[model samples]
Target: MEPMGLRERKKLATRRTLQHEALRLAIEHGSENVTVDDIAAAANVSTRTFFNYFSSKEEAIIGDGPPRPTADATAVFVANGPTGDLLDDLKHFILSPMLDLSAEELGYTFTDFLARKQLMLRESHLVTRMMATFAATEREVVAGVAARLGEEPEAIRPQIVAALGMTALRFALRHLHHHGDTAEGAGAEGARAAEIAELRDLLDEAFDALRQTFDTAR
Candidate 1:
């Protein structure tokens, strides 16, 4: 990726400060007791500034939700491209956001992911907020699936396919949460390729199993 501009870097730094402070305060105290003002105070920013970066205290603690599919990626899928098969296309479409930076540039390291997983597990009360974010992401997936099929977003086909893709993703994520250290020791996208490839491999296995299950029933 190109170097971030000064404004972008400052914005990113501010967001990271809020995230780091929010996580620290929540872990030190209790998430239920940690209000937005408290987080803002801890970060040395006004509540308005805090709200500028995150919608709520919980949002800062959980970090950003899943990235959206790029317009180009969605258009390609709608045009039946990158590959023609539906299952294959869907997998790539969903994973594309994570893989956009290329293998050497994939920045989301497994160690970071594992740490986030542990935080979520440790603070189970925040699951509801996380789920709400996930629901929004699922809706995006459904919209893309529906568009590709020339159907309404409410169509069952879109919902089912979206759920299946999410299932494989969750499977891959759960595996990574536990075994991250085994694959990549963290830092740099170059070292993180194995971690992401593992995610792709697990997704492949999951979809393959589903395909076999359905084929045998037929």
Candidate 2:
């Protein structure tokens, strides 16, 4: 990867500051009570600058930047041919973006959120906010799955698979946040690794259950 230029580094720093500040302010006050202007003020950036990075306060609060699959993941999806197990491929495609995250990056995002009791207390509200952000990503995943299967994006099968994949991901994330890393023996890195492993296990269980349900119904 190319090194980040000074300008890009500055932009990233500013965006991180805005995101951290936005979450802090939203947690201190209710999300409904916080405005973009308030977040910009807290971050010491102009409201215009905040808008340049994020369209709304919720985006800053979620703090994952944008919902986008990495280039390699996208390439893998596009290059995939008929594997006969569309559902399994769909699951892999859906999770590919997360697979690209480095261990440190995963810990920074998922583990940090899991550690925050305040965030957990507002689970419903946070989930609602995250859903809005996830909508576009869902569409993208659907398109990718459809393309891989030589079907239209609007096809019912692809749509259902995409939705189920996303639901599974959300369920796994929530479960991890609540039940992961409770052991006192594990260090922080160990805990994070365990959490990730548990997440994969949860996803596998969910998909297996789904497959079983379909088979039983048939």
User: In terms of lDDT, which candidate is strongest?
Assistant: 1
Q: Show pairs that collide, candidate 2.
A: none
Q: Which stretches of candidate 2 lie over 4 Å from their true place?
A: 1-13, 35-38, 62-67, 81-84, 111-129, 178-189
* Cα error of candidate 1 at position 143, Å: 0.9
lDDT tens per residue, model 1, 1-218: 35679999788768877877787777778788799999999888899999898887888987765666777788888887778989999998888777765433243334344556767888887777766666787888889999889999998999999989887877777786334333455545435566567778888998898889988999
Per-model lDDT: 0.76, 0.71
Q: In model 1, which range of ten residues has the least summed lDDT?
A: 103-112
State the lDDT of candidate 2 residue by residue for 114-194, as single tens digits.
Answer: 533366477456776656666778888888878776799989977887889888877776677532344466655566567
TM-score of model 1 vs. true structure = 0.81
TM-score for all predictions?
0.81, 0.76
